[model samples]
Target: MDAQAAAPEQNEVPTGAKQQQAQRPAEDLVWIDTPGIGQRGGIIIKDLRLSIKNGEFVYLIGKTGSGKSTLLRLLYGDVPLTAGVGRVAGFDLRRLDEESIPYLRRRLGIVFQDFQLLSDRNVYQNLAFVLRATGWRDETKIKERILEVLRNVGMQGTQDKFTYELSGGEQQRIAVARALLNEPELIIADEPTGNLDPNTSAEILRLLLDINHRQGTAVVMATHDYTMILKFPSRTVKIDGGTLHEVQKKTAEPSDRAKE
Candidate 1:
């Protein structure tokens, strides 16, 4: 896919450019150029370009209201792209109809800060709900898939427990298992560690990294945890002053360690 520079104004919808970009072959899981994203009259993010390839782990860092969530929403079609080109999971953001949104989401797994598990249901029921909704018909297959994903996330024995019965870290592990149920090509984790303690947060991060390594699923995690970034450095993207900037990872020197 060709990359083009974009400079979009608020309230300007570059439909033409979006169409052109969508028609090109998608070499990346997500490719956007100066995408104006948000509600029609008010654009939260303007002229933002980002590209995330398969099997890549990227940290999206920005202060609250810096459009990190909005960008993630754009990828999953929660927010419409008002301008610029965006192709996510082979779906053209410009021409994505409501009917196609679910199909697009099937290729994506979203982990939110709040574990949005059904409070009234046990782990098994919660997972079964998603499988049923996604058109998994065979009872045996659904049961087997649930068991497999639970084992994958190391939460194999917690299936009969309710969400309230699990600790924060355990709940997060269940959430991760839920995301892995469909074997999504990309997992968009929006503050997955936000509600956990530091130790639990570290464990969650390690789980995500393990999933990325073993499953080859691209992970775009939006977080404010600088400590985690310093400890597990990778490609980092920051949103500041309404634009996206790639933060270079610097190797820690002996002096830096001493200061720590």
Candidate 2:
């Protein structure tokens, strides 16, 4: 597909790169090695093992019902597996039942396409709600973090506005700002730009890339936009018929800005 590199000259990363990759830790690993759960439902995912490393920008390419969203929920502990195991930010997913789920999610930042913000709360209040709910005690730290993440998302001045008053891009930025409240090690995004225009989508991608670079926050994103994958090439994992394949693009360098 247009999203993948020309099938790789071979099926491996550069030798030294692979060595470094393998040397990394197994913790904070956001991937699903197996699937299927709940009383009424059977397995939705197969033995779907994937390991995304730290500071890497990865694209989850798959079509609808290909289990993209479900995969994300699994990482955030929203979906419990029937078999196999998953480790995200040092927490075990398979063993995490209702009680441990809160702790697992608190370590992660999740952004959704629908911008899950409260309509009744202003941007600042919305962020404050999460900070207080999650047990942030210091009033000063809460205010500081609220401002910090908002500034990170380029929405510091818009904090006083209602969610409905912002553009689609701005609303998404607020959602991202909220996600950053926990200072999470991993940021999971599901179709984050599905509703935005191309220009806005590029801005969001740039923001995500910047956060990934500055904070070394591992990013796992699910998207149907193969064109987006082509523009900013990175390690991509594709799922179809419950299979996993790692894609290594020729890889864009700073010198290849024109190509990008």
Candidate 3:
């Protein structure tokens, strides 16, 4: 592995910083404590503690099978919280029942590795389906919201196109548009750029950063692409040894030119 890709030092976040975090509970959009998360007959991670503040952008990096995806699933209510205290976007994961899962999900935006666009539907229809399912009854309002999100992701004119007709970058942009439909407080992305080339991945990452900067939506992303991180530095955590640890990179501050 390249030096930049090597695992970051564990437990490098200062204790005082951690203390400051505890004092600001109201700012955390996602909080977990000693969380027991996994499928039936098994738990992938144990005693995991995490707190993501409002409007912050963080990266989750780890090797394959390191419980990164499980953590993301737990946040979005896909996996049941078998043990421990958990909260996300104001919903308690420990108490989330099937009936309340949709309500919890509406407050979050989830992006998957593969663009999970409905193949039978065009971009407009795909977005409209979510709005309608989420109790968006007014067609005019739904169309306006869809158009706004599309424009935000820079995919405004492609609404009439099918998923197959769009490029991977464009499809991912649409996926992002779908995520933005609810104006979610947090966006949980799982290996969102895994399917794209480096250039395309850069585009998608930039788009996400723009959203984070402009909309003040908290973002937690899991990725294996360290180069992208090197290009766009932010608070990062690594999943290793069945635990999550903050990664303290020694890189210099990114130049404004790099951000542009």
Candidate 4:
């Protein structure tokens, strides 16, 4: 990654970035509450009703097969359940119908560590494709949206650069921008900074925190970076021994904080 980061691209400041910086407070409801799952299984979330506030940062910590990703996936209706209910941005999981999945996805943003950028197209085209798929057709509007999202992710100049030519951080930033194109209410990031080094990882996490603080986009990051848990120290929600509770009980409001 360092080899690629030898030069930082000239990034342009976006007008919409400010709008994205402001976030509205969130209301509380049964976000992802699982009374339990299956008569005999390994996916029981157990009364795990959770709320990821309108603008919050939550770290989901747990070992492999601990259902961390499953819980995050549940928010966007990605995981089909054997039993249990979850809701996000007003969509219910128990009654999660196929018709409503698209609606639910529009309000949520998801980021993956692998930087799933299109290998063939340049940065601009990758983002352009997403905008078109989501219903934006105006050429002017599409370019504006693409530039806006790229600016928000701090990679405005890489619009013509191929993904393979970019550094790991840059590639990940593009993924983040793609996730932001829809301006989702909540962002679910799984191992977002996993492959980067300590310094690069910190920079990426700070960028995420900035997104959380500036735009009020509630973020749920499932990672093994307990060191980051100590470094940035946002509210934590650990799936230990199979249970969910506040990390410190500081913000019992339910909408804002969950951890420990």
Candidate 5:
């Protein structure tokens, strides 16, 4: 991304680019500025300020209870932003209501750590459900979209199989395909690789990176696998002490194991 080389230590905009970035709302897919975030009158995050530009892939890393999930929830409008400015794909987060949440999500693709595929539904039915919920009507168009996303995730021709009949990796691939069904501008992935084995985790990471590059979709993935971060370096942020910090990139030594 344009800001990778000059990432800030904190959540502030990179130096020398504030004037440039301040003027480009159209270029930023996610924009947030908030004093705090929480539920039930408790603050989990404080002084949060973050921006993710179009097509950028960013890793969100932090320990449990460090507010990583809370941050992602805020981005998707699951948690209301009680104060400050917050926007995602042109929707005002602070102003999001029950009626608008679905609309906001239609423009986003969300992947969960558990895969979240319905066990009772076949792959095609799972995908078709999302398309229909998002206002797709024609059966022909829905079928085409389902096949297209399945192909993108390298999981074609399994549309007839139940999700429970698939392996973990295959199931996750279907989940990724579901996230793509809407052609969303941004993908919010929360611990997408957490449940996979090492090799499968790498596969999922590579797939997300591929989509970020190929489709120009901004991705903000929260993960605990520092190993994956080492193997596939990218712009990353760490949530700590109720705030966010940019992690300096580290060069990884060549490893045959990582290659596999």
Candidate 6:
């Protein structure tokens, strides 16, 4: 599907306290309060409050089926907010509709545990396809953007390669590159390294950190890799029993991990 296609727009008013909270500055890429979200009439998470500031890197951790994925979906507008005040990438979550989804998405980039590249197309073709679908008419600009993103992810010369031909690590890098094509304000990564080896996972982590540092792109990454958390400590948030809580970092531990 074309990630940039326009959707319908709507606005919803939060009640009482939530309405007051929603009136605050929307500087953060994502802001929510006691939000209830789910799919198909089932509430996966409730009373979840969270905020992610610009250029911040937050690790979302939890056991399997603890609502990590559902929360990520909520941020990207895949799952509708059942109740509460929420805003993401300048769009009010409560007000989100089909017409505003694409605009909301354009301000953010999403990465998945599974690489969602087009198997039949070469790397360049895959990216070009997205750009074309999004209304890019200038061939020169499209090629430049593809090459720029590829360079950012260290996949500069692999544009001619097909998706099936690249290793898992390489494919993930391409995926990251694809996510960067629009220079999104926030990057929502859901277990982006889940399928890669340890070393490759570390490489992906380093790449993401580098992007966060250099481009000032805020990142909210849902992960199960506690080892990565220990290796590259940052602000950690845990989801349990359908609620979100900030995990305090251990003090008095000295290591080489970078600080946010």
Which stretches of model 4 miss by more than 4 angstroms? Answer: 1-26, 37-44, 81-84, 251-260
**Residue-wise C-alpha lDDT for candidate 3, range 124-231, written one tens digit per residue:** 999999877776666777778888889889988988999999999999999999998877889999999999999999999988888888778888999999999888
- Tens-place lDDT digits, model 4, residues 57-145: 78888887777877777767777644555557765566666655665676677898898889999999998887666656567767777
Against the true structure, candidate 6 reaches a TM-score of: 0.87
Reference-based lDDT, each prediction: 0.80, 0.74, 0.80, 0.71, 0.80, 0.79
- Estimated TM-score per prediction? 0.86, 0.84, 0.87, 0.82, 0.86, 0.87
Q: Write the per-residue lDDT of candidate 5 for residues 74-129, one digit (tens) a residue.
A: 88888899999888877777667776677667668899999888888899999888
Q: Give the clashing pairs for model 5.
A: none
Model 5: runs farther than 4 Å from truth?
A: 1-24, 249-260
RMSD of each: 9.2, 10.9, 10.9, 9.6, 9.1, 6.1
lDDT of 2 by residue, 1-260 (tens): 11012112212233333332212265435655664433247555566778876666788887787778887887787777668766776666656666566666766889999999999989999998987777666667777778888888889888789989999999999999998887778999999999999989878877887788777788888887778777887778887776667767454542242234
Q: What is the lDDT of residue 56 in candidate 1?
A: 78
What lDDT is reached at residue 244 by model 1? 86
lDDT of 6 by residue, 12-50 (tens): 222432332234364677889855778899877777889
How would you encode candidate 1's per-residue C-alpha lDDT over 1-260 as one tens digit per residue?
Answer: 00001111211224543343344344598899855676657777777888888877889999999989988998899988767778887678877777677777777899999989999999999999987777676777778888888998889988899999999999999999998877788999999999999999988888888788777788899999999878877788998888888995553332332233
Q: After superposition, how far is residue 163 of candidate 5 from its true place, in Å?
A: 1.1
Candidate 1, residue 258: how far the Cα is off, in Å = 24
Model 3 scores a TM of: 0.87
Candidate 2 vs 4: which has more lDDT: 2
TM-score winner between candidates 3 and 4: 3
By summed lDDT, which 10 consecutive residues of candidate 1 come out lowest?
1-10
**lDDT score for residue 70 of model 1:** 88
CA shift at 115, candidate 5, in angstroms? 1.1
The predicted structure with the larger lDDT, 1 or 4, is 1
